[model samples]
Target chain A: MAELTYREALRRALDEELERDDRVFLMGEEIGRFEGSYKVTAGLWAKYGPKRVRETPISEEGFVGAGIGAAMLGLRPVVEIMTINFILVAQDMVVNHAAKIRYMFGGKVGVPMVIRTPGGAGAQLTAQHSQSLEVWFAHVPGLKVVAPSNPADAYGLLKSAIRDDDPVLFVENLVLYNVTGSVPEPEEDFTLPLGRAHVAREGTDLTIVAHSYTVRRALAVADRLAQSGFEAEVVDLRTLRPLDVDTVVESVRKTNRVLIAEEGWATYGVGAELAARIGRACFDDLDAPPERVAGAEVPMPYAKPLELAALALEDKVEAAARSLLAECGLVGSA
Target chain B: MARAVDEVHDVLQDGEQALRLLRLMLLIRRFEERAEEQYTRARIGGYLHLAIGEEAANVGSIDCLGPDDYLFTSYRDHAAALAVGSSPAAVMAELFGKVTGVARGYGGSMHLLDVDRRFLGGWGIVGGHLPIAVGAALALDYRDVAGAVLCQFGDGATNIGAFHEALNLAAVWSLPIVFQVINNLYGMGTSVEQSSAEPELYKRACAYRMHGERVDGNDLLAVREAAGRLLTRAREESRPALLETTTYRFRGHSVADAGKAYRTAEELASWRERDPIARYAGLLREHDLLDDGQLESMRKEVADEVSEAIREAAAAPAPDLGGLYENVYGDERWREQFERMDTAAPFGERMETRSWQS
Candidate 1:
């Protein structure tokens, strides 16, 4: 096993799924001959041919609907929208049809489909390109939303998404693509369970709960805090919809303080949800009120400085951690 | 045994089948009339979308389908469901919100599902069932099934995003599906002319690069002829087609609507004059297919059958409370798993052990 970038691991997951199941295929804009918009399906077309690694026309609604139809007929279709923002075009197919089919039919049928897309801001892709919609999908009942922060988890989660018996919304952060980690060699049957959070780093003073790119930011802040003698635990909430609040509550109970982080706008984002749930579940255990480090409320700005200001960077997360420490009466001692 | 196109037409024009279509249409008209009465009395809950004047369109289009063919429709689905072989008792029970109803009383007037009859569902949202119908057609083609899907929606749905997406996919893949648009002119309160750029709804099908046909929906024979041809083409060639049946709804959109706000009383009278049942009865007499006595006897027979069904459905028991959580998840174990997780160790217990270390 060798370290693979987030994009490379996603490619490996698609490659393995395609090889293992003849029915499994990838369809999206520029997925075939052009590799992928982000190279997540770079060499898959060459390996699997046009039929399996399909290059669809730029009709998100059409292709996404077709993928759902294909999945209904027992085909394992992996539909990729270039980004989460583009998925809004196919909201009817995703929310109304794919999410409601199994229940509406009295469980007679199931839509075993997967929609893969990149999300969040940091690359300065501007307003239209960089919105975080995990909370929107999470609000929906039937959809299983997963946002993987690193290469290993991306590989594991995508494989599981393709194989699951329900529709899965698999979101990858655009900025995490080049960052690498050790990915196991492709196996015939490899799948990570959905609705589980991983403890990326363990500490005692405060628990940092985050998903996608914010997981990395939280970990970096934890590293910096470690140097200053404050032990900050980090929890990577891989799946946003089926929030693994038990793991979060457990971490908070041990740490006694919490810092929630997300790349979405500050109001009503995933971080807001995490903080609310923590307050409800472990109210008595809290040493301090939960702190949230989130992106600015404005539409993601184009100018570099504005974009930088709009995002909750490592410094903000670090400051939030220090604030939590201050409330816990550990800042001066640390 | 592949038959010639002409032979298929000849087979469809049998005396028995013709009578069956007429009977089905008559039954639907009477059933809807009864439903309207029930809705007026406040017996039926939720929206009661009546498919009154559009009987010919539903009967003619559904008559072209085989037993294996799938059918999905919008909320105005009582006629469509009946034509697809769902028992009148079950449909009436569904309207009554009884447990013996289709979907076990879960889905009310808008969402009727009968998997056994291949009646997919009556989706509540306009244009919502379009993509689902396309998906079902794709499933049929992938499984090598020799059937097509008839997706019924109103003219209003033509403007929605799902309609464009579903139709485009159907065209691209050549999926075996028929987009049956019952153009009764109004989507809720908005007229087709006001909502759409093109007054001819059939022409919108051309945008998806699929074959489109406009039939006089008031004429059952014409609707049957066009539907039969297109459905045959869909089954044999795996091509999608859109068949718009231009008709009018004699009643308002729902029972509560007077339909007077949007349409003139004279216009409503004009459509009522071209009622599918009355028009077909006149045609049968003109062709010496049936006399007045036969038609009258047939009407009485249908009325009796509808009455019996209503009585039975009224007596049917309500759904059991224990079955509430039955079909929420695919696996039964999710209930146990959710329960176990809900009752797991409280945060207080875990915090006590860590307090000593602190």
Candidate 2:
């Protein structure tokens, strides 16, 4: 294993996949010469040349549909939308065509396309660019949504998504790119199965469920709670659509109290979906109602303090976890 | 993989090929009539858009395509499927929502595809398929292959954002594709003149500096000529072109529309006078290629074929309900992937549930 940043891990995965498969190619705006807005595709265009690492005009709907078409015709296309917000312009292509093509066409053709885009806040990108809209695609049946919270998962999950036969939405986080961790070496071909939740930390008293960048926040909260003598189990949901509720329920049943967290709004968000499912599954084992902490339900502000307030950070999560533990009569040291 | 492609000039001179073209158009006409009857009889359901009055526009351009060429069309796709060599029984069975249909009853009348024939889809959305067709051309260019893509849509699709994006990409990249707009006068209920600032749709290609032209859609040879020319250039030179086939639909956009609300009877009568099949048959007769009683026999033959197709479709069984989740995802592990997602009994719901809340 070698240490790499989350951005480096993703770039390494793309490089390896490009070398591994001739059908795999990249398409997106500013991905080629400009190297990408966030620089995730830096050096890829020069390495792969213009054909394999194509740069498109600011035509999300065009290129995304083009990616679908290419995937339909047996080529693997990895389209990069500069950010999750830009994907809105191509929402119809994803929701209607990419997601529905296989079933709608009666299994005649499948789109093996991967749409990669970064989502998250904290650099003052404001409301539009800072949204976590992965749940919107997750709510659809055909799509497979994967969000990696660290460098290792960023490496493994992207490799799996590139090779998967269906349309996989690979969600990256802008803030996590510079974060470094150990990832498998190039010759290992290390890959992770999608739709499985990883229990990042094992604890007994409370369960905190989260995904993507929120998982990092949850883990930090778990660490803070450990200092207070409350061991909170952190269940990082790697895949959102084919959600590994079995793992979450397993954790919830053991802990008896659960808190779901996200960077997106709580209403109809990933947290809401998990809360409903957990309520039904762990109804017998519950110590308290499933609680949730989400980003403030407002357009993210430009001011630093307001942005910090808008996000569901570790402090808020720790407070919510402590409150749930207190209700369970398991209060710990301050 | 390079093979000789026939131009419209050569095919137009061949009498036997001309007769086959006439027959294909007749077959589509007969198939649609039965489909309309089937819809009213409650045998077929959903939005059924027929190419009844625009047969030449559908068959003539599609006939220009080689076997290796890919096809993508909007909702008005019955004739496209038939013209692409999909069997009458299979097409009819699809209309009947039977298991044996081209798309196995899943893609009703609006969505039909014969993938082996390289016909990608008969998509239901208006402007959605254009970019997909352009992508197919991008694939061909990427693979450095010999085939091209032909995307057919209505006059309505020209106004959508995807239309502009698709054309711009095809032109910018010099992808091999022919975008055919079968302008049947009205986009459902509205006229092109009322909807578009520039009523002449072909000129829209100028925005991308792409080659564009218009043809008399009711004239069979005219459509064949333009499609043939553009498709050849697409295949040989890797160029993109827009061909507008100006025609009229005798029936409404869908069977639900009475068609009388939007247009005048005088206009309909005038178009009926220039009916493609009748026009072609007269032309063939004048050239001494068609003889007395030949047209009647061809009509009789096609009518019988369509009737047989209808019977076969009617007798065919509907798809099994148990197989509803078959094609949603293509991964081999999709069953396992979705098994966990089965929300009915999330882990402990069925395991001796703790009262109603469980």
Candidate 3:
């Protein structure tokens, strides 16, 4: 295994895919020359040159539609939306065109494309920029939505998403970019499948299921639980659309309690979906009523303290997990 | 379909070409007449847009497109699909929502596609297909191929954001595409004069500094010549252009609309005098290229063809109900992704089904 940051892992995935297949190309605003607003595409423009690593004008609807068009004509385009907020402008192309093309076209051809964008809050970027809109895409049919927590998953899932036969929305977390982890060494052709949940931590006292940046927070919360002699198994929901209920349910069955966490608002959020699914899967027979820890339901505030409070912080996750264990009458017993 | 203009020069200059063009237009007119009847009979469902009076605009532009060209059109695409050589029976089957239809009854009248002919789609949204057409051009350019894309939409699509975005991208990238606007005056209920600030659709190309032209859509040779030349320029110069074909639709926005709501009887009568099919037939007659007997026989032939299409489509079975969940995902991994939705036994045993079925 080799150590790499989440950003580096994503970059390597792009570089490898572009080098491996000529049909694979990148298109987005400032992706070339400027190297992307987040610098995720740094050095790709120089490495692949202009045609493959294209720099698009700030026309998300145009370029995203272009990506869909190109994918229709047998080219695999990995389009960057800069951030999730910008994708709303191109919602028609993504939801109506991209998501509906495969089914509406009667299975004749499908878009083998990937739309990679980051979504997260905490930088005090305020309401518009800080929102997590992954659930909006996940709710759609005919589209694959994946959000990897670590560098290994970032590398593996991005590669798999690019190579997939349908349109895949590869969501990244803004805060998870600099987080480092050891991805398997190259040349092994190591790649993870989409829609498989990974057990980031194996424990039995309680199960904390989360994804993207929330996975990191859940892990930190699990560590805090360990200090209290409790073990919280953390299930990283790598793929939201094809959520791995098998893994989540199996973990919950062992722990008898679950606490779902997310960086988005609790209502109609990932936490909400998972909690509902878990309750349905287990028939609401859990130790507690499947608790949840989510970011504040209001629009994210710009102030630092307000931003921290609005986020699903580690303490908030720990508190939720502790309450669930306490309700199960196992808090002090642990 | 990618043959050079000179390759078709002899045909266009002779009576054989006149017969070919007239036959296709008559076929479109006949097919649409049958489709309207089918809609009335309740055989066809969903939105049904027809291109009756704009036959010349559809056929002329579509005929110029060779094998190396890709085609996209607005929902008023029955004529466009027929012009691209999609089997009349298959087009009718698609309209009839039969399993044998072009899109297998999934995408009925508004979303016909002939992947083999490279007729990408008949998009339901007014301006949505423009960017997709531009992207197809971008694909051709990326492949360094000698091909171009022909995107057709009505005057109503001009005001949408996607239209401007598509045009700007095509111009900035110098991609190979021809944006043809069939200016039939109205975008549903709203007229072009009501919707666009600049009613001159072709002049909007000047904003991108691209070549723009307008042609008499009712005149077969005018549209054919303009589209053919522009498509050739795109393939050779790696440039994009805008061509506006002025025509009028006899039907309303869809078959549901009577078209009398916004148009005057006098205006309709005036446009009927300039009907594309009639104008072409008159021109052919003036040149002694088409006689009344030939026109009658051609009409009879087209009528039989469309009648056969209708017979087959009506007889064809509806798509299987089991196929409802198919094609939403084009991958083996969909089973894993979809297992969570299955409440029974959770993820007992999953199986991967078809992938795009292509």
Candidate 4:
């Protein structure tokens, strides 16, 4: 194992995928020679040459659609949007074409494309750059949405996404890029299965389900809960669309209480989907109704205080978990 | 008239191809006319945009393409679909929303797809398919294939964000995609002059540092020649080009409207005089390429073919209800999941309970 930052792990995954498969390539603004807008593709152009590492103009819709077209022709294209905000320009291609092609064509073709974009709010990038639009993509049927919370999962899930036959929306949190973790040693061929959740920690009192940046927050909250004599299990949902509801339901069955955390707005977000699924699969297993600690329902405010209040933090997760435990009559007075 | 004679002399292939172009234009015109009648009779549902007056533009531009080349167009696409060799019957079946339709009636008039014929689709949203076409060109170039993408859109799309994005990407990548603008004067109700800052749509291609040309859309010979040259250049050199065919639409944006809200009777009559089929037929007679009898027979044959297709499509059954859950994913696991869901109590009960309050 080698320690790597989230961004470096992503770059390493791209390099390894390109090396392993000649058909795999990367295209986006500033991804070649100039590195990347976030430096996630630094040194890739020099290593693979311009043919594999392509630099596109600031035409998100065009390049994204072009990626789909290339995918249709059996090329695996990893398209990088600078941020989730710029992705709006290409939503029609992502939502209408990439998401519906397989279904509309009756499985005649597959979109083996990975659209990677940095998402979530925290970097003082203001409202436009900070919105979490993963739910919008997750709502689409034919597409897969994956969000990796750390370095290892970033490398693992990205390789899986590149090799997968379906279009995958690989979301990265801007705040987690510099965070470091041990990644598997570089290999010519490496892939991790998609739609599987990883149990960050095993506990018996309550199950905390989260993804991306929220997963880190949940881990922190779980640690804090342990200090308070409460054991909280944390499940990091690396892939959102396929959801791995079985793992989540199994965890809920073991714990009998669940708390869903997401960085997006509370209503109709990932949390709502998880809550509904848990309600369906583990309604009897649940000791209390599933609680969701999600970002407040509004555009991310610019003010620091309001922004802090809007996001789903460790405090919110801990509080929601405590309330669930109390409702289940499992926790004594705090 | 002399220019017309000169263009005809330049590209006319034994006069049969000219007759073919005239025949195709007439077929599209009559097919759309019949579609209009069906829409009025409520046999066709949803938005029914016609290409009645713009048949020459569609046929002329498509005539330039090789069999391996691809074609993409906007919603008003009956003529383009036919010109690219989609059977008139399939086109009619599509308008009638039959399961035998090109896209199994799921596409209706706006979305038409024939992958084998290399006709990508007729996208409903303005300027939406432009980028996808450029992408297809990119794919062709990546595979080292000698083909270009003929992407047709209306004048209104020129001002949209997708037009700029697609053109810029195509120019930067030097992809073999020809951006064909069939400027039918109005974008639904909005005129070109009103929507676009630059009314000369062809000139906008220069902004992307790509080649551009303007041709008289009613002049089928000119459109074919220009498109042929541009497509050749694109296929040979892997370069992007834009061709603006200044055409007119005889009908309203759709079947419901009489098209009176936008233009005057005199304007309509003047455009009608430049009818692509009539003009091309007149040229064929002038050159002794086609006689009145042959033209009449060609029209009758095309009409009969379309009628037969309609009859067959009407007899075809609707798509199987089981297909509602089909094609959502490529994996068998997903199919199994869908099957499990189908077997579960219907989604109505579960969905009703989870419906968003807002």
TM-score of each: 0.92, 0.97, 0.97, 0.93
Ranking by lDDT: 2, 3, 4, 1
Where model 1 places Cα greater than 4 Å from the true spot, the runs are: A332-334, B1-13, B321-328, B331-358
Q: How many pairs of residues in model 3 come into backbone collision?
A: 4
Model 4 docking tier (incorrect/acceptable/medium/high): acceptable
Task: Give the Å error, residue B197, model 1.
Answer: 2.4
Is 2 or 4 the stronger prediction by DockQ? 2
- Residues forming the 10-long window of minimal summed lDDT in candidate 3 chain B: B344-353
The worst-scoring run of ten residues by lDDT in candidate 2 chain B lies at B349-358
Two-way lDDT contest, 2 vs 3, winner: 2
Q: What TM-score does chain B get in every candidate? A: 0.92, 0.94, 0.94, 0.91
Predicted model with the maximum lDDT: 2
Stretches of candidate 3 off by over 4 Å are B3-12, B340-358
- Interface RMSD after interface superposition, model 3: 1.8
lDDT of 3 at B180: 97
Would you list the C-alpha lDDT of every candidate in the order shown? 0.83, 0.91, 0.90, 0.83
Winner of 1 and 3 under DockQ: 3
Q: Kindly indicate the candidate among 1 and 4 with the higher lDDT.
A: 4
Ordered from best to worst DockQ, the candidate numbers read 2, 3, 4, 1
* Runs in model 4 lying further than 4 Å from the true structure: A105-110, A186-188, A302-306, A332-334, B1-13, B331-358
TM-score: the better of candidates 1 and 3: 3
* Candidate 1 TM-score versus the reference: 0.92
Q: Which pairs of residues clash in candidate 2, taking residues 3 or more apart in a chain or in different chains?
A: none
